[model samples]
Target: MFMGDGMSLPTLAAARTLLGQRAGRPGEETQLSFEAFPTVGLAKTYCVNSQTADSSCSATALLCGVKSNAFTLGLTAAVPRRDCAASQVPAARLDSVAAWALAAGRDAGVVTTTRVTHASPAGIYARAAERNWETDADVLADGVDVDACPDIAHQLVHLAPGNQFKVILGGGRREFLNITSVDDEGTPGKRTDGRNLIEEWQADKARRNVTYQYAWNHEQLLQANATLPEYLLGLFESDHLRYNLETDHTTEPTLAELTEVAIRMLSRNEKGFFLFVEGGRIDHAHHDNQVHLALDETIELSAAVARALQLLDEKDSLIVVTADHTHVMAFNGYSTRGADVLGPSNMRDSAGVPFMTLSYTNGPGRRPDVDGRRPDVTLEEGFRSPRWRTHVDVPLASETHGSDDVPVFAWGVHHEMFSGLYEQSHVPHRMAYAGCFGGGPQACDAAAAPSALVMPLVMALLALLRALA
Candidate 1:
């Protein structure tokens, strides 16, 4: 399963329809399919009604098989009202698939294009108060309620009695470093709590027979061999990793690179593994209404999925790919194959046709200038106006997530379990069921017992092959 970020079922369906029609010949029609997890119906049935399927609840549902209130991780809706299990004293919470894998002695890892503490990946490991609340010196020194779930950084270090995860990679150095600790660039800072989380992690790893390596850049990551560390930490920045579209000072690794490294490290475990990879920035792009940025991130996510397919053996390993939620995107007109993905706004008139094309719907106080012309300066500089001028008119509304059901695609042992639409919370349970983590017949049971007992396609092919040979 390859999950794309902010993928709207309706928008994707429209795009596929256009692509098929454009690709089809007079007599032939092309069929297009959506492979991300579908959205749940009945309002709070699939998701807790919130402003959006923000990563916190979405990821919680994906990983823990529970729908949480928005912004809370690893807690049930009754957490606020009833003080659920996660809100209690931390012994060892095993709600996450990652935790289940760790408990089963299988290696587990999480890789993301955002801060490891961010909602999507953190949903797998850390059960915290709010996704946005990272541990600051002031917050911690105030004798923060230990019973209140800690941030991802604290959870990564102290989730299990022992360091549980074998591999942990992605940004969020600020969360690990003391509030006062300056970054390697000699930047001045202070550890607010006067305790260095990185040192604590290293010391803990050394004492617990765990090898630990923390890498801040691509060079450091490449230098550290798979043999060195059973537990790895790669936080390339203080916050979210740099987006692939933006060139920045930070040495961020692409999602594909991070996935490859994690697979190599985690596969060494004999018990097999479960890893969660997130293309988190895609959702961010959608929130900002940057379609081009969103599509680019989606393509990168596809590349990572392709990498997973290349690395994993389908016979033993189950790779479940899915997104937490959907964004509201649409395709109003017929768009040709490989049409300027950035579209006409970036083009200029070649002849009688107006060539340069770019577009956007209404966003943040955007209005036409006096003459209905493009603003002189950049969109960022143009206040009280919409950016990304467009000839196409969309419904006047802020961008949002659609209520429509999304799609999920699966391949490998239990891939068939993902065939039909299901509730978002059912995903983790399905994967766990397939992976043999949950108590049930493995996904292969479904695969082995086919419906209606049709003739063996393999046998038919073999007979044809023998005849041809």
Candidate 2:
């Protein structure tokens, strides 16, 4: 499964055009990698408690096969955010697709451009009352007992599915190291418990008599013995990996490179493997209203998906591409053929000012009126820079998520199962059904055969009913 966090339809459309223009072709003639999928569907992204979903709950829904409250991960709505006691209830904790895959004797791994403990990737293993609790220090500062509610990073190293993962690659190394220790990048660790989880992880793997390798930079990752390690862990940065535009090729790996390595490691298991790849920094870029960065991240995600396709066998494997949520970024204006997506539009507004081709509903990019005239986006000093923020209607410290329904694209085996509009929670269920794992109805089960036949019709009816409701 591949998820591009906060990748809305608008973002994809704009990114496709931008990519084509860079290739010296008519913008509309291009397609993002996932756009070529054989089957496509839409998913409603609202959370149990909010009209607009947050990454935590949306990821839980996408991975756990159930909807959860906003700001919570791997829990049912019964466990509200910040309610540590309630989160301890066994019934409240949800098992994600990763757990299901592991239980079925399939190896699983995760790759992302964000912290491994961040909400989206953490949804695969960590169950937390609050998404911010990435380390012992964070939990302690929240007035929560670290022993009772282990931090997300601790869960990744010590918990069941996460510990069993064959390949774990991403950033957030500081969360795994002791506070007194410094990383190769000279960044201080944040754990207050003095536990160096990375070292502990190595010791655990050694105790199991299994071969493992850990890499802190791109050179080490590239030089890793391709067929030697049974498990691999790579952390290239203390926080999220640098955005692709600013990444150091020698020190940090691109999303496509991470995806390629993760596949090579996980595919060693004859029982097959389940891998989760996330373009998580796209969300961070969207929050900052940096449309250029967000679009570049989306393009990187497309490349990663393309890389995965090259290594996978469509006859047996199932590949899914979707987003956990959507951003408030809006792409509009009638620009001439092959115009720059990051530049101002050709048409002037009623006030005789050229607005950006891409803008936001609310963000730090909100411009104040000067003498009753909106600032012309074309005149901004850094308007062409990747760090430039597009214009927004409402002022906010950071842009917010949109309640828009996200698109789901599918290819490979049983792709037909994901062909109609459905709730976001239905995503993993469909995947589980197709993969014939998890407690849900499975494609391999005789009783589920009939229901699977009419699922598309039923889904279409439900969507119509929802619209009517």
Candidate 3:
């Protein structure tokens, strides 16, 4: 659970001046990490209790700590409303800490840069209603019943209930076939849903003995074969997989090469796995305000969290990093740490004088010109453009979602319960009580009681000034 891709809090305080560091204002602990909340009063209880921290209520509060509504997933928060009446909704189905680590037998995987049926990796494997309608226009505009909304290509050929996912990589190969199907690299326009979901996940891994591989590129995901079929499925593209500044020349791979081939196919399942990697275009470069493509998708989501801290082991793995809301893009003035985080000498101007790099505090057809050049356009283009800087400024706003407050980082094991201020659906029950699966530390004592005494002495004095800077 170390997902970083559209983390806001002033773009992590302008990406802490490109690593010279700032945020908590101490020192060191850099290598980028953060945890701050308040996403506009948790998005007004996620759009009036239809719970929506967006990214599908932060992927159902980080894969089922429960907090639906915002086009739900997994289900809880009283299910219902898919325009009701599918026998009146309500069966709900909670579980999911990757199905409780595949029901304690461990080994579970989901890597993504987007399109493992989108919406934050299909809210960790299916539960629909427009997280971009995973196709079939997301079950005919969320009225359900496109054979009842399973979708992420029918949950990667059936996931949950004791099928222990070995490793299912990203991208959505056109929601698993039917646009005129044809894989084997001919690349036809598939997705009519003729159920070729990769041949029904290779015929359900040859009658459930499990051991599969279905890649799409990067030399068949680096010539797969980690002893065949640890249940891997790559899906290079069909929608939403392309920004590493537009896939570095395609043939697709990088999200740190699909999280290092999903940590070598879920670390060869020695029963110690629950992986979910998503850098999801940092929320499409903050829904297109494109701050240099959202700081190069937050530096490739911190290079996939430095490739999961170079293959996990921070004391029996826990990792937790976070983000599900925030995006206003800030950096009030001042520069010179590492600078050049893509232009305008990092930024200044307004007599503090720096001079243009990029800007936007408000959007959608701006105006104002008493003969100052660049105006005369308005082809029925209504107006509004508060000369962009940062923070809210509406009128016809599109580049949205900024209820400010996002930043959550942790190292490992019980990560001191993600230090400080919570409630974006109590971050998946504080990461399912740091992976022992809930009910631990008295079930996150009121959400880890205000960052338990100032986030470990301020992240141990900023990790000793980022290890002696």
Candidate 4:
């Protein structure tokens, strides 16, 4: 499964247009990798306590198959954010699809541009009361018992499912190291407990006698043998990976490279594997109102999905692509065909000022009017820069998520089941059905006929079973 964080319909539309223009064609005629999927659906992205869901709540819904309260990860709504006592309750703690995959004797792995302990990736294995409690210092600062509520970084390295992962690749090396220690890049770690989780992860694998490799840079990742290692842990950056436009390809791996290596290692399992690949920086860019970077990250996500497809067989494998939530970024304006998406719109405002095609509803991008007039976008230096923030109506530190349904695109192996609208929580259940894992009805079960060709037989067996009972 793959998710583009904060990649809304408008975001995809804009990225596709930008892609087409880059391909030297009319911008509207292009399709991203997932757009060609046979089954397409929409998922409502509201949380249990909020109309507009944050990454943690949405990640819980998408990965755990349950809607959770805002700011919580891998726990049900019964556990409110920052409730350390409540989060410890096993009933309140939810198991994600990774647990389900492991229960069925399949391996699972996670790859993201964000820190492994960040909200989205943490949903796979972490059971936390708060998303921001990524380190011991963070939990203690929030007045929570550090030992009782272990930080997310500790949970991933020492806990179940996460330790069993065949592949764990992403940024955030600092989260796994101690404050006193520095990484190869001389970056200080974030842990205050004086424990280095990265070394612990390596030591654990060593004790198990498994072939594992730990990589901290692009060269290290490339040098690691994909087939020889039973496990792999790669942390490319101290924080989140750099924006695609700013990254040095020699030191930092692209999203596509990470996805490719993950697939190569995970596909070795005969029982199959469940991999979660996330373009997490897309959300970060949108939060900063950097439309160019957001679009580039979306394109990077498409490339990653394409790489996964190239390595898998459609006959047996399943690929589902969707977003956790939408953003407040708006792509508007009428311009001539093949016009630059990054350029100003053809239609001017009431003040005869041309605004960029992209803009945010609320962000630091909001510029104060001069003499009761909107500034001309074309006149500003760095206006077309990748880090440029477009126009905004409301002034805020960061843009918020939009309360809109996200699109779901599914391909391969009973993809038809993904058709039509559904709640965000049902996503993993549908995936479990297709993969024949978890407690729910599955394609492997005779009574659950996902395909039309077997509906009659399924009905006959259902009737016979009811009669027998």
Best by TM-score: 4
Give the per-residue lDDT digits (tens) of candidate 1, residues 160-182: 52257777777777776665567
| Ranking according to lDDT, highest score first | 4, 2, 1, 3
- Residue-pair clashes, model 1: 19
Clashing pairs in 2: none
Q: Per-residue lDDT for 1-469 in model 2, tens only?
A: 9999999999999999889988988686799988999999999999999999999999999999899899999999999888899999999999999999999988999999999999999999999999999999999998999889999999999898899999999999999988899999899999888889999999999999999999999888887635548989899899999999988887788899999999998888887888999999999999999999999999999999999999999998999999999999988899887888788888888899889889999989988998899988777798779998899999999999999999999999899888899999999989988888888778779555787679999999999999999
RMSD of each: 9.7, 7.2, 21.5, 3.3
Give the alpha carbon lDDT tens digit for every residue of 1-469 in model 4. Answer: 9999999999999999999988988888799998999999999999999999999999999999999999999999999889999999889988899999999999999999999999999999999999999999999999989989999999999988788889899999998888999998999999899998989999999999988999998888887744548889999999998899999998899999999889888888899989999999999999989999999999999999999989999999999999999999888887887778878888899989888888899988889998999978678888889988898999999988899999999999989988899999999999999999998988888544456677788899999999999
Score every model by TM-score: 0.76, 0.94, 0.31, 0.95
State each candidate's clash count: 19, 0, 30, 0
- Relative to the true structure, candidate 3 reaches a TM of 0.31
Instruction: Give stretches of model 3 more than 4 Å off.
Output: 6-9, 13-108, 111-113, 117-171, 175-178, 181-197, 207-238, 241-270, 290-316, 320-330, 333-370, 373-408, 414-469
Candidates' C-alpha lDDT: 0.62, 0.92, 0.61, 0.92
Candidate 1 C-alpha error for residue 456, in Å: 28
Report how far residue 268 has shifted in candidate 3, in Å.
14
Structure candidate 4, residue pairs in collision: none
